[model samples]
Target: MFLTIIVCGMVVALSAIRANCHQNPSVCLQAACPESWIGFQRKCFYFSDDTKNWTSSQRFCDSQDAALAQVESFQELNFLLRYKGPSDHWIGLSREQGQPWKWINGTEWTRQFPILGAGEYAYLNDKGASSARYYTERKWICSKPDTYVQMVQQSPN
Candidate 1:
């Protein structure tokens, strides 16, 4: 009878450990970001309320371990459009007057959206349309990949 109780207790303890590992953040695997940042499709984004020139905005994002947000698909583009405030916002697209537009991450601009002008930097206008200009001060969005996020192990409460 003692042996039976011992075996049952061992089983219960093992079961509890497994459950804790699965439910506790200390042992679980997940992706996360800093407060106020939004996560989508394995990426984290920050929409800034402060307006800055294109170059300054890009530098700010870089300081946060991210780059200016790059819209790679129509779905993502639409998502930004919907959430963007009334004012135009800076994106990662930029180029010289006659050069091909490129993202800050070194990717060529996708043709998913029409370029409204031959400006140096691209932004979403107040009407939810994309336009390019060099010196406009606008709010900006920053994005970082999941791999850049720090994985923390939390102690179970």
Candidate 2:
């Protein structure tokens, strides 16, 4: 009888430990960003303090250990929009030199929130367009930071 009780207690303790460890990887542990950026989709994205060209903004994301955000859905697009400040910023998508729109991740377009004109790929802040071909710069989203996961066991008793 005593042996059965010990085993049952062990099972309950193990279950609790497992539950705590199985946390969502995308959820950030820290409240404030280590940099000026914010966390989204398990990555940190920054709006530049200075207005940088498309190339420079990409470099900034790279230096911070995150790729530029690829907009795949309206939910993802809206997630970025909520965090946007007054000034517009660049995201990862752009038109090829020949004017073909493509995601920086190289994935074929699966979903598009606001499809642009043939020559239009990059996004801008302002909702209204003077022409169908151009858009104002808008807010950007990024993936979570990469970190090693280590499980620390705690004593329940």
Candidate 3:
């Protein structure tokens, strides 16, 4: 009985430590899925190896229990940009037609648009950031897993 009590106390303490250590929110998702992904502001993100159209990329992210990243804040956007790979990857936002950008999931664009570099947008010069279409083959960013998130496995009896 004493040993069991000690183990229980230890478990609670350990869990508390884990939660406190990741309060920054930026690293919350990372704590859940470390392999092939990183966490930022309560979301996990993963870059794809294969390039696809905007619609197709959204579908791919859906299949993987994630969605295309939604840049909700400048800090989050900067985080994405800093960690984003060298290759011009597609993001979930685009002008589609006129001025306002849209998210692939139909969420209203709440985040400020990242300043585009020359020739950077959509299909025109994906190597850079200028056009606004889905046909472009630039690499893209996707969110972290939203369901069945893997957790720290407990020891077997």
Candidate 4:
């Protein structure tokens, strides 16, 4: 009976440890990002290998509980430009038919970076961000908030 109890307790502990590590790979830090995600500043960014059109890419990100990455800072933009390699990847910018271009988060396009091609959807390549048809298929980057980092930082010290 004692051996059985010990085995059950060990199983529970092991499960808990697996859950923690699986959820966040770097638990020693406040906001550890999951596997395959890049943790930068307070955000987690994921670059996908599969190709999809602008709309499909956003839907894919939504399914992953994230959004197409929004470039808020020059540093973030540079990181993307440098790491994206050769293939062009769809970003979160698109026009609403007759309306002007905007980020996926609903911010107006302020032209922080020059867009090269002409189209309804924007993507990133070695030359920089460009716009192309919405149907143009490409890999994509997704962004989400680091799950636990902010909570610990905001909690009462």
RMSD of each: 10.7, 9.7, 9.8, 10.9
Candidate 2's error at 30, in angstroms?
Answer: 6.3
- Where model 1 places Cα greater than 4 Å from the true spot, the runs are 1-31, 147-157
lDDT of 1 by residue, 54-98 (tens): 889999999999998999778888878777767788988888667
lDDT of 4 by residue, 1-157 (tens): 2221123123233344445656765554543576898888768888989999989999999997889988887898999998888999998988866788888989998878888866888999998899899888999999887765433332232
Q: Rank the candidates by lDDT, best first.
A: 4, 1, 3, 2
Off by over 4 Å in 3: 1-31, 114-131, 145-157
For model 2, residues 1-157, the per-residue Cα lDDT tens digits are 2121133224234444344446643333534355566665544556556655566666667777666667655765776666655555566666655654666777655546565445444643545111122244334434444331112123232
Candidate 4 or 1, higher lDDT = 4
The residue pairs that clash in candidate 1, if any, are none
Give the top-scoring candidate (lDDT).
4
What total of clashing residue pairs does each candidate reach?
Answer: 0, 8, 13, 0
> What is the lDDT for 96 in model 3?
44
**Per-residue error at 32 for model 3, in Å?**
1.0
TM-score of 3: 0.59
3 or 4: which has the higher lDDT? 4
